[model samples]
Target: MNSLWSGSERVRIVERLKATLAGVVELELLRCKHLEMVDAALEDRASAAANAAELPAEEGIRAPGSTASEAEHGSTTSRRQQVSAILKVIRGHIGACVGPVFNPLLSPSLSPGYDFAAVLEWFAERVDRIILLFDAHKLDISDEFSEVIRALKNHEDKMRVVLNKADQISTQQLMRVYGALMWSLGKIINTPEVVRVYIGSFWAQPLLVPDNRKLFEAEEQDLFLDIQSLPRNAALRKLNDLIKRARLAKVQAYIISSLKKDMPSVFGKESKKKELIANLGETYHRIEKEHQISPGDFPNLAKMQELLNAQDFTKFAALKPKLLEAVEDMLANDIARLMAMVRQEEAAMPSQTVKGGAFEGVMTGPFGHGYGEGASEGIDELEWVVGRDKPTYDEIFYTLSPINGKVSGAAAKKEMLKSKLPNTVLGKIWKLADVDKDGLLDDDEFALANHLIKVKLEGHELPAALPEHLIPPSKRGSSLEA
Candidate 1:
């Protein structure tokens, strides 16, 4: 068996497990709430029944010969059933507050027709923010992720990337990957502002392997502070879902009423039904554009319809009070409970992690010792600081194109270079950078290429920390803007 296949299989299995675990934890929380709601509803109903029982027989209970009290009792029973159905609707909607990347194999409705992009857009509508997480061992942004970054640049205010599993790599490796990641992110988002990148193991505890024992032990709180901070949306997302529910309730009432118009009925009852229908029409028109949400957004609408129709809502007019009460409970307690939890978690978190890396300029360290530095340094202060060993030409190539090191034997590297540079300029870059006729760029060559991109193509000054000798002839005597 191929070792790579086994490792990939393990990863797939682990992803499935995580998705399943998330589903279980969320459902368990909801189930507990359901049990509590059921007990409260039952207790309240029992108290009401007991109160009725305590009333004088002549006042509360109809005499065996009279039917008015029996009719009232039936209405009360029907209302209780309506309350139960409404509770289910509230429960179903509460779990989907954020997008859960569900497996299509588990349920097609999650990524319906396997259109994950469309599903992602659907999720984008619901969420106020997005977390883009990746492993620290391989922090290089790939082509696929570049597309995501570009697509989400519109929501850049809400974006933050978590570089997880830092404990899996060495300090030197972590620092190198971190520098590369920041550079890649700057290019992707097309921004000078540094991207927020939380660096730590996201697991309960960082594995104390020899690879990262030093940094893992040094950072006390680890990723907890950052994870807690990521969800800090300024305002709680006020879903216009309430309007949709109101529209839905009115539509259902109208439909149920219209279905009864042809039936044999007393003139007085028929007139009342027509009046209620007209009122519902007016209410629907008033709220039609109040919210862009629709009943179609809820996946289990078929089941919900069954639940709504499951009871004897034939007396729905009488049951509206209980239905409304259930909605009120959901708004006050159920939805509030979850939103409050998120807000409290955010509030309790210490203000340490950077949100979107507002203040973090390009960081440089020991790897850039030979790099130039002087008083009043500006752009040059940002140095190439990967490690003690200078980066290789192949490393630079691989960084530019994932296909560079692949066994598939593709000309992806050439294509990548072309994409970044014009033919006339690229030929000049090749002559200056690749000093050896070996068709590869070494550290000197790599630095030269970067300098070309920064100065010539991007019209940005080369980092002043770059060794003065490495500066191309054209940029040597030119004065740079701060």
Candidate 2:
């Protein structure tokens, strides 16, 4: 719900840059019309006040400098002041109300230091020059920077690529990275044979810590100490370009105006804003068909959301029992398959004196008092009994209370499990199981968690789990030896 991202729930954003641009054009026109209306009304009101004052003079019934005329004049002046105040408010709104339409650009070709390459390209398009920076340490460009890729295609001549963090790598590595970059940018962007690539670290100056200090090569410790020539040349080039653009900016405006005359509205004005929005929808549909943009493209956003939601331990604890049952159900066949392998392994081992292992362990943990109802796990085959590829959150949810696979009355079983564990552990149990912080864990994590719930928290019989691998910290070494 925060305004940082896709906050405009009412509208869909897509391939409608021109539609928004047209709105920008008409917005100015509408503001002019509205201001004209206000000015005309004010003039008419002033004229009426003057005419009323003149009526008394024409009828010869007004005294010199009458108080009534003065009061009427004061009222007219106050009304004008109110009109000006209203206009000021409108102007402020006009400047600030375009956020919903102007955020979240579609771009690709990302490098480490050039995070804003896309936005800079958009700004570069509106202006005359562009100075793009990239970390020399990060050699390759990512496919996410679609905007940067497009900019290179269109404005390669106008861009100056600065190779930042020049001191991070050895000169040999730097040269190789630069060479690879040059080849890649040329092949990928298909720019000129040679585009400017300056070498400097613009903002890496700070007292280095132990971990980060080792990053710089020995010879590169004070590299580019007095590197100003490239930047100065770039500045001079910009100055020359600025003077040329300043002289011809008027002609450019005229050309833009002529182009606007030919541009037609994407939809009619039944409601102009609504029409533009509908046009954007159509454009998106077409774009979706041509270039598929999937949710996978924004995995980081989904990851961040999952992390934020995981912070709410109370809600997670409430849902833990249902989630556990769901996952246990989903992985039922897998578990059975694993248990068979474990049994086979146990049979392969040399026969030993039937020491009190499962019987003693189970009777001690929450499994005591006949809470556990499963075949005892074979010795030394605990962890392998459950396969890897940790259970994802989706599998757990779908298994227990399948949105599409729900059971009619499974709450009773969950209540039984809840009864086995203490109130304290059950309060925030999900945190114990979600070991990887990716909002999921495999069956091993689940087994270990349930074991802790019964044995550690409730001091009851530990249920079916990895015996030695998931033993309590104090007894783990002994369990391993035995």
Instruction: Assess every candidate by TM-score.
Output: 0.27, 0.23
Give the winner by TM-score.
1
Error of model 1, residue 118, in angstroms: 26
Mind giving the per-residue lDDT tens digits that candidate 1 earns over 1-482?
Answer: 12323688647644554543343334334334534655677689979976765565747754563366566567656755664575467442211221122223225332222333434454544554567777777555656556556545344655667777887877888889888888777887865567676676756674744565434423323333433343454335442333334334544433444434433454465555444444543433433445333433222323333333322223333223344344445444444444665467657765544433321331234323222332112224344332212355346545555333331113323633644766666566555554444566544445555555544554333333444455434344541421
Off by over 4 Å in 2: 1-122, 126-128, 204-482
lDDT at 374, model 2: 22
Per-candidate Cα lDDT values, in order, are 0.47, 0.42
Q: What TM-score does structure 1 among the candidates reach? A: 0.27
Which prediction has the highest lDDT against the true structure? 1
After superposing candidate 1 on the true structure, give the runs of residues whose Cα lies further than 4 Å from its correct spot.
Answer: 1-44, 48-200, 203-482
- Listed per model in order, the count of residue pairs whose N, CA or C atoms clash below 3 Å is 2, 17
RMSD to the hidden true structure, all candidates: 21.9, 32.0
lDDT of 2 by residue, 62-105 (tens): 86678865776676567556645754674422011111111233
- Candidate 1 global lDDT: 0.47
Q: Whole-model lDDT, candidate 2?
A: 0.42
